[model samples]
Target chain A: MAKTTTPPDQNGTKTLSDQAYQRLRSDIIHGVLQPDEKLRVEHLRQEYGVGASPLREALSRLTADGFVTAEGQRGFLVAPMSEEDLADITRLRILLEKQALCQSIESGDDAWESQIVAAFYQLEKVEESTDRDPVEWEVRNHDFHEALIAGCTSKWLRRFYSILYDQHKRYRNIALSTEIPRDLHQEHEELRNAALERDQKRAGDAIEHHILRTAEITQRVLREESLQKKERA
Target chain B: MAKTTTPPDQNGTKTLSDQAYQRLRSDIIHGVLQPDEKLRVEHLRQEYGVGASPLREALSRLTADGFVTAEGQRGFLVAPMSEEDLADITRLRILLEKQALCQSIESGDDAWESQIVAAFYQLEKVEESTDRDPVEWEVRNHDFHEALIAGCTSKWLRRFYSILYDQHKRYRNIALSTEIPRDLHQEHEELRNAALERDQKRAGDAIEHHILRTAEITQRVLREESLQKKERA
Candidate 1:
């Protein structure tokens, strides 16, 4: 599990509920808790060294992020993923992401262009290395995409996009462990170049194609995984 | 406030938390709890005649909807709206809605087209009346737009778009009592005609322009309101 390095309580002023919320969010996002897993307040309290009150508070915040579902008095459970949900998530991601890329192309400055270059270089380095862990590569991949969209001016759009992106990432991790197609990298490179040239139409077109292709590939892998599980059953 | 019909209990068994969550969600969406209002769980518990546990669950769900903010142990508060958030929201709505409209036009069967026509007729009836309870108009407006996209096959895009629509509604209501342009109904009528014609490009273009124009008008009103408030302060 990835460890969180929350700043030390230099003033001894950290709230118990805040600590519990941070730990739980990290755990859920990092797949420490299985999807649709029941979350018992008492169990989490004991594990995180917090009390019931603070544990409840932490769980409430996570519920807001769609990481957990509240079953009224039955307690919270990690949200479940289904093939239907996967399709929907990918469709939404494509819609928002393409728009974000267009906005980034229209508004991005030289600094933003340089950041995209930097992110692409870092992503290439990580993709080329076989010795590094898969998890690290996944993190770097997320960072590169984030950097690409950093020039989008809409804060609310960015925030919602981040949530959708994280949800999609969780599903992507479960579906396949293989390297994404080289064509995906090539498409990104084209998209970066188009944006740098301030060709909004081409940038938008490249982003739409890039996103839809990933969805197509991932959906196929997910369908195959489901079929395999059914065969075993 | 729109009353939600509760599911009847077979054995006279009802959970306090379930009741609280439904009521609170309705209130938030219906504009009973104003935006940016501080939400004290203890106060809510007393107001709703529920215990702490159930009230906590209700708050948790609201937080997820971006309607409320959880401050850990300090308690929850309603999410704030500003001109900035409204503008970002409108921009996103234009992008997603246009895509959804285009998809619906390209793929809608006769039944889907009929539904859009019926929804437009109903909307026309509501718009004909001069009784300007913005709240009622708001609800009808949502039904009309949802009907427009009802033919779109992707559930995830619908879900994401609904969230954005709700947030946009909140901001719209905040600025509703202010002055708006008189030709809004004409624009809706034109959009309906475009959709009926099955001209995907024209329909998408009309919807995008309509959405952006509304957003621009509301944003101007909000900015003026802020200036007034500042002057009073």
Candidate 2:
């Protein structure tokens, strides 16, 4: 069993497994481990300074989130990404996002609308600070979209959205390695405006367009990479 | 390492891990092990007549399929279901199914159309049978929907759809203890007719309606279950 080791946090404590889980999850998500790379318990224990038990538990949780795959005694590996998966994930994201926007528009209160506006403002700020670093902007961008759909009453819808968003982030990172068109910011602005005005149909359309555009761009990049690899071979 | 045991067959080969994976997957999916139940490796190894390595490998694969949870030294447990998860899964299924239907409609050839018709006919026959065994109907019903989406080109979309479908099956089984009013056969017919006629809009609408209706029914049942548990307490 993992021990609950919280070092005098005044009010509460955190478990060793929790720490391991967060560390491993971030590593996997941030591409530290690389997709489809084997996750060896012995290596992870040495790297994270955690016991094999806690490390195993963390990997287990990651497996549940679709981020990792356990290959039995062969150990764990980061889940692989492909052009096909990117397209399917994007398509599903669009569908759920549109429905979520509609529901949010129908049920969102003044607070929700204001939050949308605030998130967009922050997003715009992040968009302008391109020279600072892409990482921070990427985080803010995720927050902005999450805020957009925060008013949805369905817990399940939100959870699915989160999963899709995480998957999208991985592909987006890949796209960022290439030349990205500036039109994406403008599209985000349009989506924000539509959401602020509670124009459900317009918001839905904007969201779909935004997602599909990224998918198209990502797919093109992936194809180019494949071609480059083949040329090298 | 799990050894490959050769059972005296023409092929003369079967990996222990592969055998373990198949048996564990079926057991988990078929509800031989209840949700949120702990999976002890030693016990499982003895029970399945497999070694530790093979059992761990099987668990790893099961983890990828969202069937089990790994909790460090606490070992593994079946993934738990919640009402929130159920709703989210259904919403996702609806979204993916709608896209698949759209794609199927646009890209489905004569064979695809015929499959839909054939599946619907078989589905209707199964539904009309007086046995009313939920298990039998459930299996046939899944086959019918899968047939409807068979024309979809995206492998990722189908994979995600299948995952959501399986998750929904778990929840639906729970929901079955409660009374359901709607006739699922009618809904299937509407969806089939729309698809056959290439009425994309109608088909999409019917798909959405069918999914939401099921969600509503399941939600009601889950709510009742919660209430009953509360009263019992």
Candidate 3:
């Protein structure tokens, strides 16, 4: 779980740009940087205590990842969020995730099984805690899902899945869900059980339903928030 | 079709970095830059006739897009190739392309249908001519496929689809197929008609088979080439 939160820091090899990349990625995903906010290089340098070159390097990389948008010479901004983008992310996540879940179930050995268990255990700890931070919960939840699919050997699939997950997380963070509409624990347990039993179809269906439902719940909340803002305006 | 080839260049606002990004992307996708080859900053500076800053920025962006690998202080390298990667790319492509095709079919307007027709016509023109450059055919083929899914309103899906397409193109260029087994023309026609007719299931199945068969053919050719090289060694 700890490993999943921040990638293992490659000591002696982490360049300044790499540091800035990690910082900016965490900041964006954790919602410290708001959606569609301008990411000026000078301001970021002052905020991150890093130099201009590395900050530019980080933002450029983020731009390529779709986490940040390059506004030509105008600079970069946090990738904007909307209902449409969230729905698209959810659709792609369901597609890629189900595929990954199926592959992991078929190809995962005992070691893979244990990783899933460990990840689930950590997530359960966070879920059961009443005082847990939303961001922490998100990280733990992310680790569990990632662990479930870690057995799949396709790097490209995993890469795309994680990118979607992060983008989705930025949305999830901004619009926090206080009351999940589904049997969240049961859903996770069923997914873990189906994968463990090597019931690939069941696992895929479980994940697909889970992801789709989450999207619906989040979108409803987002719509309400926007409506409230409109009323205030 | 032309709009699909390169994302309609932002009129007059294409920065030096943007130019470098496009140039390097084209070179890597078209196999002008070989895999695992070093991308020295100074050489690219001279070759691209751009300052080092923009070239570095371009490479960093490409690194995030997975076309190029950044090697810490060792600079960058063109992303390496492998059978595993091509298989993953093909699998993800089918998943994404099928979804996009379904969305396009469900929501596409008359304009979308016309674009598909026009793109197919251009591709046919190139396919029928024996004297055309393979690269030109590649461009037409890309546009035709892009036009097929032009109606999918999901920017994320389209963005991921294009990235996968570019990565797949890199593989296609690396292992040029001397003998294509699939009826390439028929596949394109089916894709075009399926979209126009709004036949979602057939479109999905057609694209799945098309992509899978292409993958098998490319993998076979790649394996043969590697084996011959080994034998020579």
- Best of the candidates, lDDT: 3
RMSD values, in order shown? 5.6, 5.2, 5.8
Model 1 ranges with Cα > 4 A deviation: A1-32, A40-64, A69-76, A177-185, B1-35, B71-74, B130-133, B178-181
Better of 1 and 2 by DockQ: 1
Interface RMSD measured for model 2: 5.3
Clash pairs for candidate 2: A57-B72, A72-B57
Ranking by TM-score: 3, 1, 2
- TM-score on alpha carbons, each prediction: 0.83, 0.77, 0.90
Better of 1 and 3 by DockQ: 3
lDDT of 1 at B218: 73
Looking at model 1 chain B, which ten-residue stretch has the lowest summed lDDT?
B6-15
Question: Highest TM-score, which number?
Answer: 3
| lDDT per model vs. reference | 0.76, 0.77, 0.85
Per-residue lDDT for B137-164 in model 1, tens only?
7777888898788778876567668888
Two-chain complex of model 3, DockQ on C-alpha atoms against the true structure: 0.69
Candidate numbers, best DockQ first, in rank order: 3, 1, 2
What's model 1's lDDT at A71? 68
Q: Model 2 Cα displacement at A39 (Å)?
A: 4.2
Candidate 2: residue A182 Cα off by (Å): 2.6
